[model samples]
Target chain A: MTNETASAYPGVSALVHKHLPKVPFTADKTLTDANITVEPAHFLELMQGLKERRELAFDYLRNVVGIDMQDEGLVCKYQLHSMKHRHSIQVTVHTPPGNPHIPSLTGLYAAADWHEREAAEMLGLVFDGHPNLKNLLLDEDVRIHPLLKAHPLQKMEIAQGIEDRDPGFKF
Target chain B: MTVWPEERLVTADAFNTVDMTINVGPQHPATHGVFRMVLTVDGEMVVDCEPYIGYLHRGLEKLTENHDYRQSMGWWDRTDYLAGMACEMAYCMAVEKLGQFEVPERAEYIRVMMVELSRILSHLMFFGAFGADVGSFGTSFIYAWRERERIYDFFEEVSGDRMFPTYFRPGGVQMDLPENYEDRVRWLLGSIRQGLEDFDGLLTGNEIFVERCRGLSPVSQEQAVDWGLGGACLRSTGLAYDIRKVEPYSVYDRLKFDIPVGKTGDVFDRFIVRMAEAWQSTKIIEQCLDQMPKGLVLNPDLPKTLRIDSGECYIRTEGTKGEYGVYAMAKGGNKPYRMKLRSPSFCNLSALKQMVVGHYVADAIIILGSLDIVLGEVDK
Candidate 1:
């Protein structure tokens, strides 16, 4: 948040927000040199660009986590570092109240696999391209997201109807 | 590679070249405590290896959500049972940072002493396990464990639990060091040094250990960095970067110690790095003891329930294994709506398959041993 910390990693904001306008669903942008905040859609491309460019080369995907904001929904936050550039940035993908989904960054970072699995299991966020989409740190049959503000009871008969009615199911 | 003369072992026929599939535990000795690895093998050489975790997953993350901030300290102790004090310290620092609580100088010194002592104990386990993996078996392991027991005694005396010491609180340690603690720790320091000397004679210079370890599983520095390796694993790759040095959390900036590195990132280099680090940890404990102060162990300013004033912060600290982080978001509520743990072993273990690719099956155990993963922390 301080100027010194911001200036410590110079030009990070420009590098992150270069392709920001192209992406849909972006929120308020904090273009500090140390950190940047972009919407979830922009986050995927920003990570992709960071990986390809030799100047950026943010190869190490350290952590991906989901945070529950009450009244609001889940926020998927990612921390990335370029060991080559000696810089770090945080990206957040905010999801609204009822349904939370974010583009899976596992293709960009293999370490994102287990982390995405953890987030999906904990917050019920469906990652579009995760290789293994099963539960992590919880039983497979768990019907509720533990980290949510409301402890969603199974209401078995009704919940099953909603799950079955999901239009994405081709079968 | 010459094939064995037996036609049944060497044949292309399915009936002759029968490769038995074995599930080598949620309880195998080499799987390292409740970790199940389904191995498909062809006569002692592994064709495929699939690691299955969660045998020790007691849902600590979900369980912590139900408890208060103070109550969560007990759960942190159980996560990394080997480096229990480090786990306690990391979680405590997260809560303190969130609440803006300041620890007394005395408590800092005690924590430094206790954590360094635990670091030595953990490295000893690494040594013992590495030796056992390299086929020295009980000879070196029992010797390392023998010295480690004395350090456990000191932990028990202070924290009241030998294995999992829930001694660190939000702002400081649970209690002051017990009477005559200095004498006991000093004695341990000497005894552990002597034990290291004996351990060196048993395993370090021996031809078998040298041959099995020297050139096997050599991870390039770029690969290590790409995989997010930390602690001794990163140190062994000539990085010379330690979280204790770069990040400077706790009293690490004030303390003086060398970050040992290796020329070639092999199993032997890892062993050397850990051995040298044990001596460095001893040096740190001595300094912490010398600069020991007298004050309150817990901060009186810290509230019983932590309700940080409307914000989110991600705090990271150097655990004995690597960077153990706690990400806490407070909506000014008594319990956190979200808490994410960034465990080091999970990242380090992600690199396991890559490290073992070209190496023989025998060398895989040694490679994993060098990584020094605690499965509980890895799965959690």
Candidate 2:
């Protein structure tokens, strides 16, 4: 691990290093909270270790956000808090340009169910093993990922037209 | 051959019934604000539940990403419309954290006062609406509105609009409190306390309301934390883990108040916790009034157009409902690269399926109401 990453949250970094020394983890600096960036390959194992470790019991999955980096790839961020320790950390997972797949945390945290679905529907990040990864906060039939940077913000009339459905009878 | 009325004896298998699906609200009043849930029932007991949202999703995050930092304040307030100021505070705090803006000391106290008042406003709404769900109907709603209107009047006097004030800026509030506001708020508190007493007599003191909610859907502290429940719902389970107390934000550290926890995390516990929390909010406001210093409300060093080189922060505040968190990332621009609201109502509502699965159909509605979910936040 880099010095900057270790310095962000020294206690958590020390704990992560002691438990999962083999995992290739790097630190990302943020204005607030300890953030660590990891690849999709090591995502699940690292998360499991974080939760199972007695001293670093990050049991509560606070928030999940998916960001689209046009050139790099899609990013999935998970904010976790240990109710026991009251310390929080942000986990960042990046998938290559076309592959937006990451392991789901639904098994470990029940809170991941809706959050993963929301992330999936919003930015099209696929969470493998999420039981019902259907469209959330969107129509069941709608397949578009509105949050992707490629998707333009259109006017209401133009957006309605793009859907290619019937504009019901006018009065 | 047809059996006579008393001749045939009824066996357990004789009355076999098929499971039925009942759809409640994209419009129903009990579901509360454009939320819909499909419940599969074995007679009266709900076997399964699937909630449908997004009818009100206006792409809040998308809108925030598109607009300037200050321009998006209007949309954030609408998330928890019942407590608009509380949502604004979270949004502003996130912006301030990312930009490293210093808010005037007076503004912090004012922001805390308004947010606490907003919390009371939200809890009163829950009290009224939950009372209606428990069969009190219009009486409780009217009683809640009596205090709510008085509070709204104060809000309107401070800011032009009542519901979505959009009064908080990144560095501070849009403007200072109105002159003579302290006297008005003191009078309002007296009226609000009386309103709480009336609700106590009408709902809490009533045996029917007590018995109906007492043992319903009890949640353990571990279960609450595992399910990511927050606010009164999590506290009802005896966790005593309030964001305000555990992680003090704004002026909460200076204030003196008690976090009311419940013995059993049931519907009744959720109700009582919120009631006690509302009472505590009044105390915090009174403290703000006593300790508030005279100074500028907005930061003097703020630029006309705020810009940050690059920074990211997840700021969490004790929203009226729960932990209202904002994960903000700014990358060399007036607008943030990404802003995500970890709305309390959304997280609290996510565990509805587990909470409502084994309860009666009527009781499921009560469970949903007890969660005190504002759909605007959930769908956003």
Candidate No. with top TM-score: 2
Clashes of 1: 0
| Global CA lDDT computed for model 2 | 0.89
Per-model CA lDDT versus the true structure: 0.74, 0.89
Q: Second chain of candidate 2: TM-score?
A: 0.97
Candidate 2, B178-222: lDDT as tens digits:
889988889889999999999999999999999999999999988
- List TM-score per model, in order: 0.86, 0.95
Mark the 10 consecutive residues where model 2 chain B has the least summed lDDT: B2-11
DockQ of 1: 0.27
lDDT of candidate 2 over A21-90, digit per residue (tens): 8888986556667788899999999999889989889998989999998889999999888888877788
Instruction: Please provide, for model 1 over B1-380, each residue's C-alpha lDDT reduced to its tens digit, 9 standing for 90 to 100.
Output: 98777755734555556675668677767766776665566777666666666667765666666667887788787777788898888777766766667888889889878888888888898888888888989987899899889899888899889989888887888888888888777878899899888888888889988988888778788777777787788778887866676657778888999889997788888889889988999999988878887778888887666776554556667777777777666556666555677888777776776676555667777787888888878766
